[model samples]
Target: MLILTHTLHLNRPSGKVPIEIRLYQPLPTGASWICNFEIDWPEVRLARHGVGEDALQALVIALQVIGAQIYTSPYHEDGSLRAYDREDGYGFPVPSNLRDLLIGVDKMSF
Candidate 1:
């Protein structure tokens, strides 16, 4: 089992804020891998589960779901929140190691 914890910064026009997200395979409470998320905006706190052959695969699935939600968020549609784009000058940089890990995974379903 592997545990990954990362802080996502939402670069909203108002300012940047951090959201805490964690993924753990074979969750401490159950048999499945779980993604736990907390966001200050709209005050959301929830967890979701995914299935995969290994911890990294499971982590990718969880990330896909989380990312989907982010895309669908109001922030995305309004252009208030933007991802790391060099020209746009928005969003924060993801840690190097984490960026490499995410880049290694091909986009997949949850």
Candidate 2:
């Protein structure tokens, strides 16, 4: 069982929104593990972040990591979800066009 926890600070005009999570449910692939995810922590932030955009992308990228996928679990002890090979995620954020020059540049072509 591999659990991934993410923390973000949402600044809202009404008040400061705090403590959001991205939960990944682990799955078995062949003999190793894989993951799919759903959100379980805060409902309010979902209103602002809008599901299926930022949330799922973050979880997927985090798991298909280059060197490591094993991390600490953040779910409550009684959390009843289990991981599987396929991921059923909800609510992700649409991305902005702003590019980070430090990443994803094709150096050989340049």
Q: All candidates: CA RMSD in angstroms?
A: 7.9, 15.2
**Poorest 10 consecutive residues by lDDT, candidate 1:** 101-110
lDDT of 1 at 99: 36
In model 1, the runs with Cα more than 4 Å from the true position are: 11-14, 26-41, 83-110
Q: Which numbered prediction scores highest in TM-score against the true structure?
A: 1
> Which residue pairs clash within candidate 1?
none
What is each predicted model's overall lDDT from 0 to 1? 0.48, 0.31
lDDT of 1 at 110: 14
Q: Against the true structure, whose lDDT is highest?
A: 1
- Tens digits of per-residue lDDT, candidate 1, 30-105, equal 4554444333444676566655555555556666655555545676556554334343312222323333222111
